[model samples]
Every structure is written in C-alpha cells, then in structure tokens.
Target chain A: MNSASEAQYREQPAKRLRNAAIRRTGSSAFMTLLGKECLELLRSFKLVWVPIVFVVLGIMQPLLSYFMPVLIEKAGNMPEGTVIEMPPPVGSQVLADTLSQFGLMGLLILALAFMGIVSGERNSGASALVLVKPVSHTSYLLSKWVSMMILTWGSLLLGYAAAWYYTWLLIDFVDVGPFMLSYVLFGLWFTFVLTATLLFSTFLRSAAGAAFSSLGVAVLLSMLAGLMPKYMGWSPGALSGLAYQAVTSEVLLPLNSVSWWSIATAVIGIAVLLMGSVVLLKRAPAHD
Target chain B: MTELLQVKGLTKSFGSVHAVKSIDFSIQEGRCVALLGPNGAGKTTTIRMLTGLLAPTSGEVRFHSLARGEDHRSLIGYLPQTPAFHNGMSGMEYVVYSGRLCGLSASDARKRAMELLERVGLASAAKRRVGGYSGGMKQRLGLAQALVHHPKLLVMDEPVSALDPLGRREVLRLLQELKSETTVLFSTHVLHDAEELCDDVVIIRDGEVALQGSLAAIRNEHRRPVIELKLEDAPHAINWAQSFLQKSRTDELRYSWLSEAELQGNRLYMTASHMDVARQGLMEELTEHKVPFSRLEVGYSSLEDLFMKVVSG
Candidate 1:
C-alpha cells in the first residue's frame, strides 16, 4: 500500500529542483534577512532609542561648551569685575568634541544594544531554525553586519546632523568638506567597533562578555593610538583621531599620508572580522 | 523506493572524545525512519550533523533528489529538539520570513505561511507575538515553517520530548499525518514512539549502531525461546535460584543448555539454546533440590527484553 502511493507521489516530484537551492540570489536573501533583522531591532525598540540617544548626546556637548564659561564664572568667588576673556568657541572644536562624545556614549549604547546580535539568536536556538534552510553563513553574517551598519551609521548621521545644527547656531560656521571628512572617518571607526562586537558575539557564549570584550578592544585601540600616533597611525583606531584632526587643523596634513592607510586598514579589519564571524558561525550554528 | 539521503562513514569527535563513531544509514524516500537511542547515545549529535547545524568530523552526508550538485539543505527541513524563534515577531511573520529565506517569493511565502498556519492550528495565534506562545504552540509553528518550502525530506530531533502529554499526543498525530507526505527522519529515546510511528528503527548505543533494520524484521530476528519462573518468597526457594544462577555462571558444562539466566528477587528469567533439554535439566534439578515455586511460564522474549539485552550486553 505504501509503495503504491510512493510511486504516485513521485509524479509531482519536489517543486524546488535544479538550482532551486541556488536560485535564491544573494541579494534577495540579503534583503530579506536585512529586513527581518531591522524589524527585530525596531520591535525591540533599539532602533528608536539608539538614534534618539545619539541625537541627544550630539546636542548636549555643544550646549555644555556654550554654557561652561558662565557656570564657571558664577561658581567662583572672584573680584567683582574680573572677566575671563572667553572667545566664542570654534564650530570645528565643538564638532570635534561631539565626535569624542560619540566615541564614548555612542560606542557604549551600540555595544550594549548589538552585543546580542548572533549570541542571542544562538542562545534562543533561533539560528538553528533559520540556518537549516539553505542560508549561507556568509549571507547570514553579512545580513547582520548590514543591519548593524544601518543602526550605527543611522545613529551617527542623525547625531552628527544634530551636532552640526547646534554648532552652526551657537558657534561659527564649520567647513562642509572637513565636516564630511570627519563624518566618514568617524563612521569607519564606528564600523570597526560594530564588527568587533559582532565577532565577539559569535565567539563568546555570554552576551556580557562579548559586549565587554569588544568595548575593551575599542578602548584599547583608541588609547594606544592616542599614546603613539606615528607608530599606530595605520591602525583602525587612528581613524577617530584623524577625524578629529581633519576638522581642527587648518590643513588636512596628517590625512595626506596616514589617513588612506588607516581607512584601508579599518575596512580590512571589518572584512576580516566578518569573515571570522562567518567561519565561527559555520562551525557551530546553535551557539554551543 | 529511491534512497533520499545517504549518510556514510559518519563520525564526529570533539577533541579526543567521540560523539558519534563511524556509522552508516540511509533514509528511503516516502518511509518514516526513527533514529532510536537512549540519552547521550549520540542521537542529537547525529541529527544535528544531518541538518547541517554541525559538521561531521570525518564523513559525508549525501542527498539524492531531482536537483543534483546542490547544497543538499534545500531538499530537507529540520526541527531541533527545542524549536527557537524570534519572540518579537508574530507567528505569521516568522513563518513568512522562514519561507522567504528558503527562496520562496513574497506572495508565495505569504500564501504558504497562511496555509500552513491553519494546517498547524495556529491561524488564530498567527498575529500574536511568538513570545506569548506556549511550548506546544511553538512546536506547532516550527512544524509549519519546516513544511512551508515543501522539502523532500523532513528531519526532527526529539520533536515531542519537550511537550506535555496532550501536546505529545497532538504532535504524534501530526507526525503520523506528515510521514505519509514525505520521508520523515526523527531521533527519539522513547521506544514506544518509535514502535508506534516508524517503519524502520536505527538503535544506537554508545556512538555505534546496536541494531538497525525494519521494526518487524528486528522483532522477529531478536525473538528468543525463554522461561519465566516466579518462585515462592521463602528463603529456601530464593537460595535455590541464587545457587542455580551461580552454577550457570561458573560451570558451563553442568548447565550447558542455559545460554543466559538472571535471578531477580524471587523470580528468574532464563533463556536457553535448546528449550527441551534445558527444561528437562531444570525440572530434574528442581525436583532434586525440592524447590518451591508458585508459577512456571514459557513464552517468547519481548522487544523490551531484547532491548535490555542489547543495551546491557
């Protein structure tokens, strides 16, 4: 009885055949996964709050700079007319402070929010289900990276825009070229941190460990570059300092030789990080 | 019937520890096969390897279908022991997302998502977040998503083990229905479940195959001549049984017909190479020793008895 039905059942064959598995173009899968991940970020409220926090952080630094002199003068007991000659701060200086603020608070918020990208799915066994469906590890990891980029870049842009608006209103007008250069360079630095977080997320089972370790790497990179610039000039960490240099310096001299190497190395770092994540994920999909 | 999946020389090792030793098995198209084993018997490990979640340390898994040279995953659907889903997404959305990942177009995925949701009795809960779902509901949703792409082969790991009795029964009923549609391979420790729903059983023990064959064939092949005796609980009767077991163990010539025997409390279960000679020898010894016994029954050994023998020996 079973065999009779089996023969008849063979008539239809499987609907998916002959490149059906290969038929799924990389783009559609990427888009679908990217869309799915974005929705998850939104549903979790990370999408809304991360950027909002960035905007607030961006606005705060300039406002604080504008108000610090008055607060200082009022607080100190001094001769009645002794006025501290406080020239209005430069817009470039205020913007650079804003990027530093992003370097601190922005990385913190992003590290906390995205620390669980792969680990959370793995711990929950959700990846086990999604992974079984012919999805390539490259596609999976790439989709995640793309989504994290959306959040990181989106927050950076909104935050930078907010900072620009305030600096223009409160301080002098900064150059569009320097501002854009600084923005790209800072964005690259943020990308490095995001990739590190994702890599650590895949490597470590504990979400806290992943977040802390990635943040630790970010901090160490930044500090090492700060301590020794010529030696660590090409390191991805130097990109942030270069971004600060781009806006504050009269000419883009440091950027002439060091900037390209730093940008290239940072891009390469993101690529290597993603590749490592894909390899690790391919080795064990269920987070064990 | 055509063979749908071929697993050959399958071995998995974690450093120095072997999780699954060299094993070979094949799943025939349109037949339900159960990979049956006890806990820690490498059942889950084998299922994971089959589903591509874990790479085999040294072996190959081949899938034969209309499409050749494919990644082999497109032809298969898998459900892990515990099905996990994004808690934030609604059931309907999750299923559609799964379908899309499997290469279905947007409309096709949406259509199948709705159809499978109703089929799995999750249509009412389709719009609700998966976080609010019950264990049974999550499992049901897992099945629906697994079936969405019409995979040629379906593999599951302990599908019903995490469910309540009612949920277990419900999933079992669904499995019964699903087995008729596609080749189903699932791992489970429950012998009764394997016996109830599978056409073939592959029993593994300690990372190797203890027994693998059609259920009916194994039942017939392992059936052996047996004798069961429930003696009186008196000391003398117990002593006699113990002495007989000791003699059977130490002196084979004196009890050569007894292939195996064990004494438990006041009862004895014994199997022999020759039933008549063993019975005659036992009766004479019983008469000579003045053994007290309430009942003496003879019957064929059950599958549980075979299972115990295979597992223990």
Candidate 2:
C-alpha cells in the first residue's frame, strides 16, 4: 500500500475512537443543561432589559455630564458682569458620579436580575430537569455564580471606561492614574456583593422573595449603621460607599479593621448561602 | 429483562399526611408502564422520588446498570404534568438547554435538539417563543426536552392530560414510537390512554397499588362482561327492561345499566358481563316478553371498566 493509504487507515481508527468516546461521555446532558440556562436567561426580558438599560445609562450619564457646562456657557443667559464660577471637570468627579449613579445602581439591578435564577427554576419545575442531568448541584450553582460574576464585572468595566472617555473629552487634561487602582478594588467589592445577593436569591422560592430578602438585609444593615456610629465600620454597605469616596478624592481614611473583617465575613456568607441553596434544591419536592 | 429502575418501599409525608406510602415497584427495560390513579393518589410524589427531587421519608431508589455506574442519576428524563419552562425562550433553545443540563456538549446539544424537535412535531415552531405556544404545542415541547439527551428511562406525569384529542393522539403515537428504544413510565387519570398505549398497567389508589399487571391480566382479573340494549325511549325501555330482567330471574347471569344517550328520536344505550350468559338471558327475555328494541350489542370490558373496578374496589 502507498503511504497515503496507510495514513488514511490510521485516521479512520482515530475517528471511530473519538465517536465512541463522545457516545460514552454523555456530553449531550451537559450541553442540554447549559443551553437551557442560557436560553432561559436570554428569554428573561427583565434580565436582558435591565443590563441594556444600565449600559445605555452608563454611556449617557458621562456624556451628559461632560456637555452640561458647555451647554450652560453657550446659553450666555447670565446677568451682565455676573461670573458663573464652575469647578473644573475632574476624572475623579466624573468617575464618582457615574459609578455611584449608574455603576452602583447597575450592579444592584444585576443582583436583582438574578434573584430568581435558581428559585425560578425551582418554581417552574426546571430543577427536575437540571437534577436529572449528569451535572451536580455544586456545578449548577457555580455556573450561575460564574455567569453573573462575569456579567457584573463586564458591565462595571464598560461603565468605568465610558465615564473616563467622556471626562477626558470635557476636560482637556484628564488624569485617571490616581483612581485606576482604587476603581479595580471597588469593582471587586461590587462583585462580592453581587455574588452574595445571587446566593441569597437561590435560597428563596420566588424572585420577589429573593430580591426583598437581599435588599432587606442591605437596608437593615444600613439602618443599623446610621443608628450606631460603631456599626458603620462593619457594614458591607461600606464597600460601595468607600469605593465612591476613593474615586471622588475625598479624605481617604484607612479602612477600619472591622471593615476588613466584614469583607471576610461577606465571603464566608456567600459561600454558605450558595451551599445552602444547593442543599435546599436537592431537598425541595419536584414540581411535577 | 433487566430492571432499569428499582424503587423499593419509597415513602414521603408532608407533616401529618403521607403523600407516598411505602411504594415498591421496578421498571424493566423496553417496557411501557402506565401508572393509573385518581387525583392525589401519590403518583406525582412517586415520580418526584424517582427523579431525586424529594428524598424519601424512608426507602431506597436505585438505578441499575447505568452507563456511568450507580450514581448516574442524569440518565433519567422526566416530564411533569405542567412542565413550565422559561416562556421567553424559543422551542429550539429550550430543548438544547435541557440537553446541556443532561451533560451534552454545546454542539451536540444543538444537533440533537433539532432532531428531537422534529420528532415531537415542533420543528416549524422551533424559533418561536414558547410563550405563544398552544397548550398542546407546549406539551410537545416539554416532551422534546425530556427526550433531548436520549435518556435511558423517561418518566412522564400525566403527559397527555392537557392535550386536545388530536394532540393526545399525536403524543401517544410519538410515545409508541419511542417505546421501541426507551423505557416509559407515565402516570395518568385517563384509563383509555393507558389501554391504548400501555403494555402494563399499575393502578394506584390511596397511595397504594390497588391492582397491577399486564393490560389483559388486569381486565381479566377485575372486569365482568355485560350486554347493552338501545331503544327509542330510554325511560320507558329501561323501566320495561328492569321489570323483565327481575322477572326472568336467571341466577347464572349478572349485568348492570352502563350509560344512555339521546340521539335524534332514538335512545342509544349499553350494559355489560359474561357474553354467553348475557346472550342467553337477553334472548329468553326478549322472546318470552316479545320486547322490541332498536339495537342489541355485545362488547368486551375495556381498561376503563377494569380501572373503575380496581379503584372503586
């Protein structure tokens, strides 16, 4: 036989072996579950719509802020000899305004968007489909966690960049150097909170229940912080507040030890909530 | 035959009430078993336990000879009575996602999804959002999701209850085609569905098996044959027939009035029992009394008859 024919013979066996492996692997089960989740997320106009709205808001907020002074100057409606003194448009101020108004709200909205990720499936009998797959409860929860994390991080980064560009346009000299490291730190904090909220959502049966529960926790903590000065250092709400302050060039106080401790506690809290949701799901009756 | 699903002494209770009570059964490969029961007979609970959705209060459920060993819970496929999916998704997207949940790769899931959708007759609606689907179409879509991964065992809870007559026939036909390759255990309150589709029937009552066996065996065990007479007037004919039947006093024959319907100017009716006894008794009565009837028909007991007997017994 020629060398080409020998090569063909070798390739044929390899191809057959690959087919056999695919059959044995049950890869179809995993794909089916992933496809279902992605499709469900895609179909959820609330989830898809909220992010698009936030991104649009993110882009618009910075551009609007950049042009407001220009528009005011062009109007020339001030009284004669009256000087309208305006503060220079700094990158930090733009970042702070955009992050607080759009970025923070966006993260909160994203968190609320996933409040039904696991619970909705539970209510809709989709969990029955998921459990029967070759996937484990841990992997199921992890998949949602990973997907939400990436989406939240991506949205925040996009907002951050949009605001920076708009600020640069408004002010000829834009300095993003000082706030860059702090923005990254703040993004991590937002991601952590987002993960915690999602974990809470999984534990409840309805989207409303999950959203109320997460928001209730945050609101209660904030109330406690206001009522008692000492409570502010340990509240998870400080993460967003601190990040906002850092970006705005406010007096940067060293995070109290309690704040650091709260971050650790938040991490553990998220893990526990996620694992608890998985266990609850395993025990919940199949909605047949 | 290999036992594909082994459920033994499985039980579940909600506080004071027992939803499923020590249910024991096994499903063999290549067999279609119909779980017959009235409302609240624990059929749903049994399915929940089998699918690992609820932990049994006390009992065992084991899947034998799975491709991935004993822990292969993913090899089973389940269809709920009201299979509520994310309504925002297209049919194709829903089926593919169901495949992925079962461990299929992305490309493979998409490929199999098309084939399953076509099998369930939802190919044209593949790209349409599920929110707009009719009830039958939704049920068909649910079935497509259940079969996307080519599961070894498919457990359906009242799979055809929500369908219209035409849709029911279509789903039943699809299920019949599937029986050649996969094991099917479906629960239904509709006995005709069981009679027309099932090879074996397991009648459950009050959270227990009232009767279970092959369709023929169940009919033979619980059903007694009877005769039906139709007349122009139901009230007058029934009154005359009842009086005549009482006077004839044939101890060897037994029968009862089944149902009656008014059609045009004539009354259509039926009754049921042993064919020979019914025939002889009817002939003697009709000949001696000179009773005139529009039509006389003899029919065998159906699964409905057997089911009523078992559930009522």
lDDT of 1 by residue, A1-288 (tens): 999988768755554453453655556777889999999999999999999999999999888888889888888797888978887888899999999999998999899999999999999999999888878889998998999999999999999989988988887778788888899899999999889999999999989899999999999998988898888888998989988988787665355667688899999999999999999999899954
Model 1: residues with Cα > 4 Å off, grouped in runs: A1-25, A73-82, A250-254, B66-69, B234-236, B246-257, B274-285
The models' CA-based lDDT, in order, is 0.89, 0.71
* Residue-level lDDT tens digits of model 2 in B63-112: 87643234545567788888777777788988877776655777888999
Model 2 spans > 4 angstroms off: A1-94, A171-178, A226-229, A248-256, A285-288, B66-69, B105-111, B225-302
After superposition on all CA atoms, what RMSD does each candidate show versus the true structure? Answer: 4.8, 8.1
lDDT of 1 at B170: 92
Going through the candidates in order, state the TM-score of chain A alone for each one: 0.89, 0.72
* Model 2 Cα lDDT, one tens digit per residue, A171-257: 433356545644665666666566656666666666877776776676565466556637665665555565665666644546568
Worst 10 residues of 2 chain A by lDDT: A25-34
Computed on C-alphas against the true complex, the DockQ of each candidate is 0.73, 0.41
